[model samples]
Target: MKRWLPLSIIAATLAVAGCSKAPNGDTNTSTSSQVAKTTANEAYLALADDYFNHDLALNPISATYVGINDYNDQFGDQLTDKWLKQRHQLNKGFLAKAKKIDRSQLSQQLQLSYDMFVYNRNLDLVEETFPARMIPFNQFYSPLFSMAQLGSGGSFQPFETVEDYQNWLARLEGFISFLNRAEDRMREGIRSKVVLPRTLVERMIPQINAQLVQDPTESLFYAPIGQLPESFSDADKQRLTDAYQSFISEKLTPALLDLSVFLKDEYLPASRGSDGMWGLPNGKLWYQYLANRNTTTEMDVDDIHELGLSEVARILAEMDQVRQTVGFKGDMAAFFDYLSSDPQFFFDTPQQLIDGYMGLKDDINQVLPDYFDVMPKADYEVRAVEAFREKSAAGASYQSPAVDGSRPGIFYINTYNLRAQPKWGMTTLSLHEAAPGHHFQISIKQELTDIPQFQKFGGYTAFEEGWALYAEYLGVEMGLFEDPYQYFGKLSDEMLRAMRLVVDTGLHAKGWTREQAIQYMMDNSAMAETDITAEVERYMAIPGQALSYKVGQLKILELRAKAEQALGDKFDIKEFHSQVLLTGSLPMAVLEDKINYWIASKS
Candidate 1:
């Protein structure tokens, strides 16, 4: 979603109600009542475009990620107390203005957009009550990691021109400023008695030090200098090199060093010992809002926790059948051990492992047409995760290609510990992270030239992650996983999501300790210890994000089953998938309503 902004994560993870002065060139809506005058659905859409464009300019990192280059040299304001206040005012004003439009007059498509915009605004207002900004930079997600990706010359930030190099020099200034402000914000968190878990702080300190390079030439920021275009004149190249050296040493390095010292010497000493959100003020209610936002459901914690427990048990019974099929003579725990340590199940080299995923591409392509007609035009490539981020990053994630096709969509396979990436998980991992999962769903959204920008680029976490998880199960329909070991891999991946339901809720809502959550995961699945540890810490660092994957997947599966039942022979898999992908990511309720309408029409 960087095509949108890394800062957009702030907007995504916490839907804070915000208000700001509209950027220059926004449609001049002189009064709050003006929305009523733009009643033609297209006019209303034009206004939505204006509002979204204003956001793109505000979040320049997002602009770079999404391929909008106007703010390529800028960085969002660090999460200052002032920034937070303005963001609140901005959201409140927009929500109020949008409310002036007559929803009854709009076409069905515009109506859906209108309802989602309003729902998101209201959700943001609710999120304004939390202290998320306090713990801004986690091991999993932080400005540090995002900036490293950009400066390392391998990510969204372009370095094809001298100005591109200069643009980044300017952007680094903003990032350096943010690091200082980060310490200030965390200090405030300390004073307010809101602090991150000790486990997360332990992880974050190393992340900060890893970026604090003393020598200019040795910096990851120096990476682009090495790759400067051959077209650059000798004089220009020398000048740019000197400038980058100065910027990294004089400006960036000191800031990183200061951040390193502050986090270790000051912040870490004051961090929370508790592992769950239950340790914070109004923690229960805080976790509740997160749960609702992630799942887009009002289900009680007990219900989600119970659902997780039930799913885990059901998946285990299936795992036993796989064990028997593979001719293992032991119970589930022994099978888990055999799968984890067995040489046959582990790849000897990273290239061999990557080759395995690449090989799946041909097999996947053949079966793809039978299950669905819609596919993204964009080509996707599989690559190992960049060394800088491989450790903390999820096993695999799909970054959408630049809509303009300057870049190919990348499937980043984390090869940190080859064993953690079990051979059994490869097929399902490739499906979920590469084909017909994130790449298919996300690329389809960006390719939607006809939809409103907010609809095109915006997302509901449950809907998006849920769609990817649902895609993993789609493997079976495609006749993948004929090998019981591979089918068990699919089940193992499915079990991980089910376990997320239990541990995410258990840790955040049910007072489960970090160790308790880890133990529960170990008992339930054959996931590697490193993977399990990182995941538990991730849930701790970000409370309810893990809940979204399973919650969204189950809903899609249920809805698909409903469509098949109602339409009988008329149900077409291709059309059903096309509807899901073409509509873009949506809230669970909105998606369900849309699907139900299709079901009725088919009947």
Candidate 2:
């Protein structure tokens, strides 16, 4: 979960190899070629800059969340037709100009810029086909929930000045407008037969109902009013408080009521009964497109399914070895059940869960240098997932540092369910989400000097998440998986990712029910039923995203083996890792190409 901001342009001047002739007696031919090359570089860089700034302006909240404060905390008016047209036109114009740039003439970094821009444009095209706004209020990862976060105390919203409070007031009004537009777009989805799953709609009912409680003072959004800047005059404070109360009662409550009524009355009944994407029009084609887009490869659903099965078999055999070493008196299924039900492995309290991860930071730091040559200068911290969103969040996740260094990278452990946060799982989780995992890969990429901002900060999920998953494997080499139970935990975690490959495709491609997907997971792995249910629902909420981790990890491992075989004694693990991290995040295709080039250069 690295925070990716929109791409910015490079301002470097290029040096050309030759000169040109002048109109005068003095020959200037030698300088003319250099001037032309410099001009071309400048044009490309300028185009990138324009595209980046324009994108941030249109999606201000996304920019803010990623720590791009150019818009200074303003939110977008997503409801207005004028805003929608402006956003579409911005993408179109950038794509048109980007197409004109001769990619072959640019450096490798510039070429990546061209490719990412094209990929983003392609996404824009497909995005129009799906009516995502129709089912916006999921239990996890909703824009509405994010809005409450930004406006609440103890978060990013600044309340130091009167102007700061006023800024939020303006933003709140825009949020109301955005919700209205979301309702309109969902209505369109209802008509188009692209509604959300009924199960997801049912889950959302409690969330919407919770917001409708009659006391504005007790509402989460009221925190801003309660904590208004101390510098404000008493008169101003009273006026602001009264205004917010009125706004919440009159405008915000009605908006929430309208949205809830629509979801319950108009949208839920029309929601799709089937869980898979294959139920939609052109579903097979749609899923194929998603598979390629997410995996960053042309491999079809069948290929991915087979790959997952093979990996699952291999990891299961490894898990069995751990069972025997511990002298467990049962088969693999019994071992899994023992692992799931064992009380000694579970955390009793959430703080104990948080402390376990906090202690690992130093332990990992001491051991990381043995396996990785490149390390991030950016620091990291461990924290519990925010209470509001933790129930639906992944078991553990990472948020990358701000490009400007204002914020540290965060490893958020979900402490919502202490039973789910096993002590044995902590080491592998730490390795994947923190040191030498996401925090290492993402922060170092952002710190690179020679690449364009987009390549530095932009992320392909397969590359980012896959690299993190692969990082867990590296822990064994670093001697972190010493305990047999911890080793079992590593394999268990890998199995979960491998299962994602099977179950995600099963849900979105093979038309698996939510229960069917959950059952597949329970039958295969040691995860709790509660965890399996959460994961399956997450896939339903955001299709094609879960498939990236295992897919990307396999590709990286494949490349490493190839490099090791080719270079023989010349293969330096540190150097191989340096090459990968130095290039920043790339599509799997581009990553493979870069690795191939590195291999050739070594030869």
Candidate 3:
């Protein structure tokens, strides 16, 4: 799921809107003094706090991710029509009250919050138009994998205290209950003619079945019992272990098996054969909305489609040049074959791969301070993506640290097929997933104390993913992409993002089949076919998401180019980095404003 997959994690943070209504309700009347501005800003922040606190109760998953433990035991049912109604009402309420605040009276920072809140709510209102909840459980982000990730020891679910153990017992009951409701909604989806792709349903079946074990002790839910805090008395340990065993064997297994049966016998036949959301009712508009929401820009599918074609051509040329410079015989395809089959380019074992990334970790930390003034206090570790979900996982992903720093941020490298994890790609991948990439951006966002709580945890994919892609390019400045193959790896990675613009839009908007998308990817890059298939299916499972990487990366590059051109020799690379990052993750438009403001002030 990496099990912290990109689409789900980004979606988790997306709901956290930046702005809110001010305290004591809102006043639209203009006031012309710094004192009035200060008063309003204070009021706005208070509302932001209230809005954040309110959401924690409404969405406990959001709370757990944000490190707010108040609702740790309550796994709220977010699948029901009732839940969406509550969320809709909440958004409308905030939208109404927030609009009454006079923007001219708010500080620039508060104005950013106000604008983002307003933008996000409008988008949420747009989302209400789509029937996404009808088919909520996908292989990429269903309740099944989400629960597996939580119970699987290394993630958000704390195992520190006896209460932590007990909290999960209660939590899984709600999670299991949701399983039936999820199936119920899928049935409703069938009635509404809203069904997931047949390919995606096939994937979901195994993920659900993965948790169905006859022995309770072997269950992931029972894992915490094995790691029970040492401080627990002998009696307490025995009792907790008994509780978990009974819960898993009796309550949990039946629920998992029930959902799996529904998916296999009832749901799979109803699933459609089409790849894109465009095939659904109102699907064309849904894809359009998803593109805007994910990219946080006004780009349509055609604009993104053409941009992908241009970038793919440019990257292919770069790859060709690398093939020649490396003195490899034959064409780019032959070189892709050579690079892929060469035993010298892969690890014999998983430990070697882990050791390789760990080595990069030390070297990167030594060089990072030279490029940027800001750094994350939270440390990160490299681990293989856990085995249960590794089959469908991305090559690498980063999970932000627990806000309290008990668990370090993780850079999960998928070591399932060491052959697929190419040696040359490691450096660029490391930078993107770890230091100066996701770890740097996400951990820094988590560490920022000056932003509103929603903005602190909130993110837009374009800003978050764009900064990471930009980080991948930073390897050139750090002197890491010196080897021609390593540089090719960078181009390959960039090409993948660029190809996303092509294949992703091509799949959903242009009617490219799965075979067609896979063929296009293979023709263009040296990526493993296994990796290519996983990636192609990922785009199928979650549409318009892959578009975010290229769209985001290009924007960041554009802004940086502008900053350098405007600031001229006055440009400080470190300052430019800090200015973009210091505001945390903003919508692309808001990010532009922040960077342009920096450029103007410096000029």
- The lDDT per prediction is 0.84, 0.79, 0.85
User: Model 1, range 1-603, lDDT digits (tens) per residue?
Assistant: 213212332342233213322345233433222333223454557667776776776677888888777887888784877777777876788888788778775655567778888888899889988887777778888787788788877678999999999899889888877777777778989998789988898898787788777788988888999999999999999999999899888888888888888888998899988899898888889999999998998988779989999999999999999999989998999999999999999999999988999899878988888877888888899999988788888888888888687787999888999989989898998899888899889988998765678887889889988988888899987888899989999999999999998998899888899999999999989999999999999999888888899999999999999999899899998999988887688899988888887887777
TM-score of each: 0.93, 0.91, 0.94
Order of quality (TM-score): 3, 1, 2
Query: What C-alpha lDDT, on a 0 to 100 scale, does residue 150 get in candidate 2?
Result: 78
On a 0 to 1 TM-score scale, where does candidate 2 land against the true structure? Answer: 0.91
Off by over 4 Å in 1: 1-38
Model 2: residue 553 alpha-carbon error in angstroms = 0.8
Q: Which residue pairs clash within candidate 3?
A: none
lDDT of 2 by residue, 104-168 (tens): 65655566666777877777766656545455557667776788877875455566777767777
Query: C-alpha displacement of 597 in model 3, angstroms?
Result: 1.3
Q: Could you tell me the TM-score of candidate 3?
A: 0.94
Q: To one decimal, what is the Cα RMSD in angstroms of model 3 from the true structure?
A: 6.8
Error of 3 at 154 (Å): 2.2
What value of lDDT does candidate 1 attain over all alpha carbons? 0.84
Superposed Cα RMSD, model 2: 4.1
